[model samples]
Target: MKKLFIFTAILCFSHANNEMEALYLQNGCNGCHGMYGEGMGASPRLQGVREEVLLRRLKDLQKGKTRSAFGTIMVSFAKALDQNQTIEMAKYLSNLETKVDDERYEIEYTPAGDGGS
Candidate 1:
Protein backbone atom coordinates (compact mmCIF):
# COMPACT_ATOMS: atom_id res chain seq x y z
CA MET A 1 0.00 0.00 0.00
CA LYS A 2 2.84 2.41 0.83
CA LYS A 3 4.52 1.61 -2.48
CA LEU A 4 1.31 2.21 -4.36
CA PHE A 5 0.87 5.56 -2.66
CA ILE A 6 4.41 6.58 -3.55
CA PHE A 7 3.85 5.60 -7.15
CA THR A 8 0.67 7.64 -7.34
CA ALA A 9 2.38 10.67 -5.86
CA ILE A 10 5.20 10.42 -8.36
CA LEU A 11 2.74 10.20 -11.23
CA CYS A 12 0.87 13.26 -10.03
CA PHE A 13 4.10 15.25 -9.69
CA SER A 14 5.21 14.23 -13.14
CA HIS A 15 1.86 15.22 -14.60
CA ALA A 16 2.02 18.62 -12.96
CA ASN A 17 5.54 19.20 -14.26
CA ASN A 18 4.46 18.27 -17.77
CA GLU A 19 1.46 20.57 -17.55
CA MET A 20 3.66 23.46 -16.48
CA GLU A 21 6.10 22.83 -19.31
CA ALA A 22 3.26 22.77 -21.81
CA LEU A 23 1.88 26.03 -20.46
CA TYR A 24 5.29 27.70 -20.59
CA LEU A 25 5.82 26.67 -24.21
CA GLN A 26 2.27 27.34 -25.39
CA ASN A 27 2.46 30.88 -24.03
CA GLY A 28 5.68 31.59 -25.97
CA CYS A 29 7.68 32.11 -22.78
CA ASN A 30 10.69 30.33 -24.25
CA GLY A 31 11.00 32.98 -26.93
CA CYS A 32 12.02 35.59 -24.38
CA HIS A 33 13.11 33.45 -21.44
CA GLY A 34 15.31 30.54 -22.37
CA MET A 35 13.88 27.01 -22.53
CA TYR A 36 14.98 26.48 -18.92
CA GLY A 37 13.87 29.94 -17.80
CA GLU A 38 17.50 31.03 -17.89
CA GLY A 39 16.52 34.38 -19.44
CA MET A 40 17.75 36.01 -22.64
CA GLY A 41 18.53 39.49 -23.86
CA ALA A 42 15.93 41.76 -22.26
CA SER A 43 14.11 39.04 -20.36
CA PRO A 44 15.07 38.59 -16.74
CA ARG A 45 15.80 35.14 -15.38
CA LEU A 46 12.73 33.41 -13.97
CA GLN A 47 14.42 30.36 -12.50
CA GLY A 48 15.47 30.70 -8.86
CA VAL A 49 13.27 33.75 -8.31
CA ARG A 50 11.04 33.47 -5.23
CA GLU A 51 7.56 32.11 -5.91
CA GLU A 52 5.89 35.05 -4.19
CA VAL A 53 7.85 37.53 -6.26
CA LEU A 54 6.98 35.76 -9.47
CA LEU A 55 3.33 35.59 -8.46
CA ARG A 56 3.21 39.27 -7.62
CA ARG A 57 4.91 40.29 -10.85
CA LEU A 58 2.68 38.08 -12.92
CA LYS A 59 -0.41 39.37 -11.14
CA ASP A 60 0.73 42.92 -11.67
CA LEU A 61 1.29 42.33 -15.35
CA GLN A 62 -2.12 40.73 -15.65
CA LYS A 63 -3.53 43.92 -14.23
CA GLY A 64 -1.67 45.95 -16.87
CA LYS A 65 0.93 47.35 -14.54
CA THR A 66 4.52 47.76 -15.71
CA ARG A 67 7.38 46.71 -13.48
CA SER A 68 10.07 47.79 -15.89
CA ALA A 69 10.52 49.45 -19.25
CA PHE A 70 10.01 46.11 -21.01
CA GLY A 71 7.23 45.02 -18.67
CA THR A 72 4.49 46.17 -20.97
CA ILE A 73 5.45 43.37 -23.31
CA MET A 74 4.56 40.83 -20.62
CA VAL A 75 1.06 42.11 -19.98
CA SER A 76 -0.60 40.20 -22.79
CA PHE A 77 1.15 36.99 -21.87
CA ALA A 78 0.28 37.29 -18.19
CA LYS A 79 -3.33 38.03 -19.06
CA ALA A 80 -3.48 34.77 -20.96
CA LEU A 81 -3.14 32.83 -17.69
CA ASP A 82 -5.88 32.53 -15.11
CA GLN A 83 -5.03 32.99 -11.42
CA ASN A 84 -4.49 29.31 -10.70
CA GLN A 85 -2.25 28.93 -13.72
CA THR A 86 -0.26 31.95 -12.63
CA ILE A 87 0.34 30.35 -9.25
CA GLU A 88 1.32 27.04 -10.78
CA MET A 89 3.71 28.70 -13.17
CA ALA A 90 5.33 30.66 -10.39
CA LYS A 91 5.80 27.51 -8.34
CA TYR A 92 7.23 25.63 -11.29
CA LEU A 93 9.70 28.33 -12.20
CA SER A 94 10.82 28.97 -8.66
CA ASN A 95 11.58 25.30 -8.19
CA LEU A 96 13.79 25.13 -11.24
CA GLU A 97 17.57 24.81 -10.79
CA THR A 98 18.57 26.74 -13.88
CA LYS A 99 21.51 25.32 -15.80
CA VAL A 100 22.53 27.06 -18.98
CA ASP A 101 25.30 25.98 -21.38
CA ASP A 102 26.95 29.24 -22.30
CA GLU A 103 28.71 27.68 -25.24
CA ARG A 104 25.41 26.87 -26.87
CA TYR A 105 24.49 30.56 -27.05
CA GLU A 106 27.87 32.25 -27.35
CA ILE A 107 28.42 34.53 -30.33
CA GLU A 108 31.76 35.20 -31.99
CA TYR A 109 32.59 38.87 -32.28
CA THR A 110 34.66 40.28 -35.15
CA PRO A 111 36.24 43.69 -34.76
CA ALA A 112 35.89 46.04 -37.76
CA GLY A 113 39.64 46.48 -38.08
CA ASP A 114 40.32 42.73 -37.91
CA GLY A 115 39.20 42.46 -41.55
CA GLY A 116 38.71 38.73 -42.01
CA SER A 117 36.25 38.65 -44.90
Candidate 2:
Protein backbone atom coordinates (compact mmCIF):
# COMPACT_ATOMS: atom_id res chain seq x y z
CA MET A 1 0.00 0.00 0.00
CA LYS A 2 2.82 2.38 0.88
CA LYS A 3 4.56 1.62 -2.39
CA LEU A 4 1.37 2.22 -4.30
CA PHE A 5 0.89 5.55 -2.63
CA ILE A 6 4.46 6.54 -3.41
CA PHE A 7 3.98 5.59 -7.04
CA THR A 8 0.82 7.61 -7.25
CA ALA A 9 2.53 10.66 -5.75
CA ILE A 10 5.38 10.35 -8.22
CA LEU A 11 2.98 10.07 -11.10
CA CYS A 12 1.11 13.18 -10.08
CA PHE A 13 4.32 15.17 -9.67
CA SER A 14 5.57 14.10 -13.07
CA HIS A 15 2.25 14.95 -14.61
CA ALA A 16 2.42 18.44 -13.11
CA ASN A 17 5.89 18.94 -14.51
CA ASN A 18 4.73 17.85 -17.92
CA GLU A 19 1.82 20.26 -17.74
CA MET A 20 4.12 23.11 -16.79
CA GLU A 21 6.44 22.33 -19.67
CA ALA A 22 3.51 22.27 -22.03
CA LEU A 23 2.32 25.60 -20.74
CA TYR A 24 5.76 27.09 -21.24
CA LEU A 25 5.92 25.83 -24.79
CA GLN A 26 2.38 26.90 -25.64
CA ASN A 27 3.21 30.41 -24.44
CA GLY A 28 6.11 30.62 -26.94
CA CYS A 29 8.72 30.81 -24.19
CA ASN A 30 10.65 28.07 -25.96
CA GLY A 31 11.41 30.48 -28.77
CA CYS A 32 13.65 32.50 -26.45
CA HIS A 33 14.36 30.35 -23.45
CA GLY A 34 15.56 26.96 -24.62
CA MET A 35 13.39 23.86 -24.36
CA TYR A 36 14.98 23.09 -21.01
CA GLY A 37 14.70 26.66 -19.78
CA GLU A 38 18.41 26.97 -20.51
CA GLY A 39 17.88 30.29 -22.25
CA MET A 40 18.98 31.52 -25.69
CA GLY A 41 20.63 34.56 -27.23
CA ALA A 42 19.29 37.34 -25.05
CA SER A 43 16.93 35.40 -22.80
CA PRO A 44 18.01 35.01 -19.20
CA ARG A 45 18.42 31.50 -17.89
CA LEU A 46 15.27 30.40 -16.06
CA GLN A 47 16.25 26.97 -14.89
CA GLY A 48 17.65 26.80 -11.36
CA VAL A 49 16.56 30.31 -10.58
CA ARG A 50 15.19 30.52 -7.01
CA GLU A 51 11.44 30.00 -6.90
CA GLU A 52 10.73 32.98 -4.69
CA VAL A 53 12.95 35.18 -6.81
CA LEU A 54 11.48 33.93 -10.05
CA LEU A 55 7.93 34.38 -8.78
CA ARG A 56 8.67 37.90 -7.66
CA ARG A 57 10.27 38.77 -10.96
CA LEU A 58 7.41 37.33 -12.96
CA LYS A 59 4.91 39.20 -10.84
CA ASP A 60 6.83 42.39 -11.37
CA LEU A 61 6.92 41.82 -15.08
CA GLN A 62 3.21 41.16 -15.10
CA LYS A 63 2.70 44.42 -13.26
CA GLY A 64 4.99 46.36 -15.60
CA LYS A 65 7.25 47.20 -12.70
CA THR A 66 10.46 45.70 -14.02
CA ARG A 67 13.20 48.20 -14.76
CA SER A 68 14.70 46.65 -17.88
CA ALA A 69 13.34 47.34 -21.31
CA PHE A 70 13.66 43.64 -22.18
CA GLY A 71 11.16 43.07 -19.41
CA THR A 72 8.58 44.88 -21.49
CA ILE A 73 8.33 41.91 -23.76
CA MET A 74 8.30 39.63 -20.76
CA VAL A 75 5.34 41.59 -19.36
CA SER A 76 3.31 40.88 -22.45
CA PHE A 77 3.92 37.18 -22.01
CA ALA A 78 3.58 37.13 -18.26
CA LYS A 79 0.28 38.94 -18.41
CA ALA A 80 -1.26 36.06 -20.27
CA LEU A 81 -0.75 33.72 -17.32
CA ASP A 82 -3.00 33.66 -14.32
CA GLN A 83 -1.42 33.87 -10.86
CA ASN A 84 -1.55 30.15 -10.35
CA GLN A 85 0.04 29.36 -13.70
CA THR A 86 2.78 31.87 -13.03
CA ILE A 87 3.50 30.28 -9.66
CA GLU A 88 3.56 26.83 -11.22
CA MET A 89 5.96 27.98 -13.90
CA ALA A 90 8.27 29.52 -11.32
CA LYS A 91 8.31 26.34 -9.30
CA TYR A 92 8.84 24.11 -12.31
CA LEU A 93 11.65 26.24 -13.75
CA SER A 94 13.39 26.71 -10.40
CA ASN A 95 13.63 22.96 -9.94
CA LEU A 96 14.91 22.22 -13.44
CA GLU A 97 18.36 20.68 -13.71
CA THR A 98 20.78 23.20 -15.21
CA LYS A 99 24.32 22.60 -16.41
CA VAL A 100 27.28 24.89 -17.03
CA ASP A 101 25.46 26.63 -19.87
CA ASP A 102 23.34 28.30 -17.21
CA GLU A 103 24.79 31.76 -17.52
CA ARG A 104 23.05 35.11 -17.61
CA TYR A 105 22.04 35.86 -21.19
CA GLU A 106 22.47 39.47 -22.18
CA ILE A 107 21.96 41.37 -25.37
CA GLU A 108 24.71 43.68 -26.53
CA TYR A 109 23.79 47.21 -27.36
CA THR A 110 24.15 48.78 -30.81
CA PRO A 111 23.55 52.50 -31.14
CA ALA A 112 20.55 53.34 -33.26
CA GLY A 113 20.60 55.67 -36.27
CA ASP A 114 23.98 54.28 -37.09
CA GLY A 115 25.12 54.67 -40.67
CA GLY A 116 27.63 51.98 -39.76
CA SER A 117 25.11 49.38 -40.84
Which candidate number maximizes TM-score? 1
- Residue 34's lDDT in candidate 1: 81
For candidate 1, what is the total of clashing residue pairs? Answer: 0
lDDT of 2 by residue, 1-117 (tens): 999999999998888887786677667786788867888866889989999999998898988987666767778898998988899899999998744332212111222246344
lDDT of each: 0.81, 0.78
In the range 1-117, model 1's lDDT, one tens digit per residue, is 999999999898878876786778656787899878889988999998999999998998999998689888989999999988999899989987655655323212222345566
Question: Each prediction's TM-score against the native?
Answer: 0.76, 0.75
> How close to the true structure is residue 11 of candidate 2, measured as C-alpha lDDT?
100
Candidate 1 local Cα displacement, residue 39, angstroms: 1.1
Residue clash pairs of candidate 2: none
